[model samples]
Target: MRRDELEGAVREALSHQVAVARPLSADPAGQAIRRAKRIRRRRTGAGLALAAVATVLVSTGMAQLGGDPGRQGKPVVVIGDPNPSGRPIPSATVTAAAPTSETPVDVLAGATLIGVSGGRLELPGVGPAERAHLLPSGGWLVVGAPTTAGRSLWVAQHDGLVQVLLAGAGSIVVAPDGRQVAWRDGTGLLVAGVVGTQLIGPVRTPVPGKAEPVRFIGDNVLVRLDPDGPGHTLWRPGVGELTAGSDRSTLNVYGALPDGRLVGQVSTDDPAKTCLAVLDPKRDLKPVLTGCGPELSPDGAGAVSGDGRWLLVNGWVGKTSGSLLVDLRRLGQDLTAVPAGPPVSGEVAWRTESEATYVDGAGKLVQVNVDQVRTGKVAEPVSVPGVRPGDRPVLVTG
Candidate 1:
């Protein structure tokens, strides 16, 4: 055969091989491409759906963790002005008062004299005392039994007039700014302001196992231990239940700062061993103060200064139950303890950021400078009349 005939035969063979290797039908090729695209689309959709579900789950978990779901990732709104005009006036300067009488004032009596300045004595209204608190704005919150079956809650004004705020109340708590008040009656939690009182709660509320006290967390928000047990529930009125935290330890939260920091005690199985800790409720339950001992009162009863810089703690010093001033800035890292004189039966009042008032061991109302306390110097106890020996005084200042 000729060269041209051989080449023609080879070309025909190559064409036949190419045809055999090619796809059998255009329909099959189009179908394969379409099927690959559908698989890619399905995979993409599935991934997006999984991400969305995960986001929802995360949000739900955060809400259960005591975060305000509506305000998540946002700043909280704090009510009331920290500083107003006409504050820190000389007439309001309680530390300047001097005790004059050793006469025992029966605080349990309907009316009791709280303090004396110059020659004048400050006497608040009288009643069967249930509980008393000092308002941050400068006054007294006196709750007592007006009748055998009912209760009376009054705010003793700066002018010596007692304002009847509530009747048939069981518990009361003043707001951080002292502009509002909260009380528990037969119905539930009732908040009162210049506007008026409104009930916020389960009408037929179950009785708390212990005296469940109402505490203000924000201007319009408050927290109470779940009457059922150790956990806590936050209430924001119109906002409904905002956040909640389960009790992971035996720490009892006494008070919370405006920023959501908690001041409480961490109690061990042994009653004698307890420590006061400042905790961040929003974070894991670890305390900012690791050192726990007798320095912190077992009752965990302490007061934070309005500036949030100082903490006045009531605890036993040796055999005597006394009060100590702690600087919050150095908490957990260093212990800056300031002696608040001898222990009194009642609460200590802060007259200024650096000065506080308490009843001395002799039953005399005494005022001391916290800075002097830090220097290991005990200031002379200025005597105030009307407060008797063994009488517990609830100190309040603006």
Candidate 2:
């Protein structure tokens, strides 16, 4: 009975304490009321916060995988670039092949001109489409615009040589890779040191003191020295001055008359200084005619002289059908042609016109008849020790 009464007294005291917490006690009814209000305020704040979050998600168009309170009538996202019809997607890469084997390739990218007619190069990934050229011999030919090089000219020849410009007729051979190039300057001819962006020459035939045009020929740069004499010479970087090596070089000039006959502006009056002369780069004397002028040698025909002093022509032009024997000399009204000895080397590889290299196996150059290119053993044999150290000879044929 005592225990039960004590329990009842403890419960009554707790109830009394709770009632006084809001009122006068240190724990009063006033404090209890404040506590109750705080609890109610917390519950209300939490419910409002949840309601605000739900409202925000619905208004902002943000969504979760499952539909939420914010989900009204919005559609689900497909997650990729979508085609409503659901068509099959194809790949972007391309594979192409031409229908014909013979196609002229005029434009190219990332290409290298390995020879005169064709070249080798990497195909570009963009721009105009390019097709490879297949030769009759099953060899590959590439045609493209010139490319920048590591001190190399864009042109290469069939003989696997680079074209090097020079000053005179004598060619200046440049070493492979264009590190060194041979050149001539008047009497100064050398096959020695060269480098990137070096002075080729003063661009003068006679070093350009006169007002003459200077141009970069395949193997050399050309300029008229006296403009009157046979002095229009080519200039190269290491080479000082040189002329076209062939006997009919003057006629071979673009501005010259096709028949080796000059009717245009006369450069000089004195025949001694103005006459067509071929200078042996190693020798000091000048010869009458130096190279084979094809246009001037038409079936025993002769070309009129510019100065009206002589007739220039090939000595034995009518003898061979395709052979060219260049012999130019001064002829009086007698019409009797004077013949000179020792033939000049003129043929160059079209692929690499500037390199001073012959594709024949002959160590010593021999003159050929141009008429025989169709059949008469046209390809001459030339060999230059280490230059062509193969059993088969290097060829300088048509």
Q: Whose lDDT is greatest here?
A: 1
Kindly report which residue pairs in candidate 1 clash with one another.
Answer: 98-383, 98-384, 99-383, 99-384, 100-385, 110-126, 110-127, 111-126
Give the root-mean-square deviation of each candidate in angstroms. Answer: 29.5, 37.2
Angstrom error of the Cα, residue 238, model 2: value is 9.0
Q: Which stretches of candidate 2 lie over 4 Å from their true place?
A: 1-119, 122-206, 209-223, 226-230, 233-278, 282-285, 288-398
Structural similarity to truth (TM-score) of each candidate? 0.57, 0.24
User: Model 1, 308-368: lDDT tens per residue?
Assistant: 6777777666676667766767667665566676654444565667776665555456666
| Residue 355 shift from truth in candidate 2, angstroms | 16
Q: Write the residue-wise lDDT of candidate 2 on 1-398 in tens digits.
A: 25575344335433321111111223121222233223221111111111122111111122232243322233221111111012222111111222331112111223221122222222222111111232221122221211221111122112121111211222233332233334332233333322211212122223333313332333444444433444444445445444443322232232123233232111233332222333332222224333222323212222222323333233343343322222233221222222321222222222221112222223233323333432334434332222223222122111
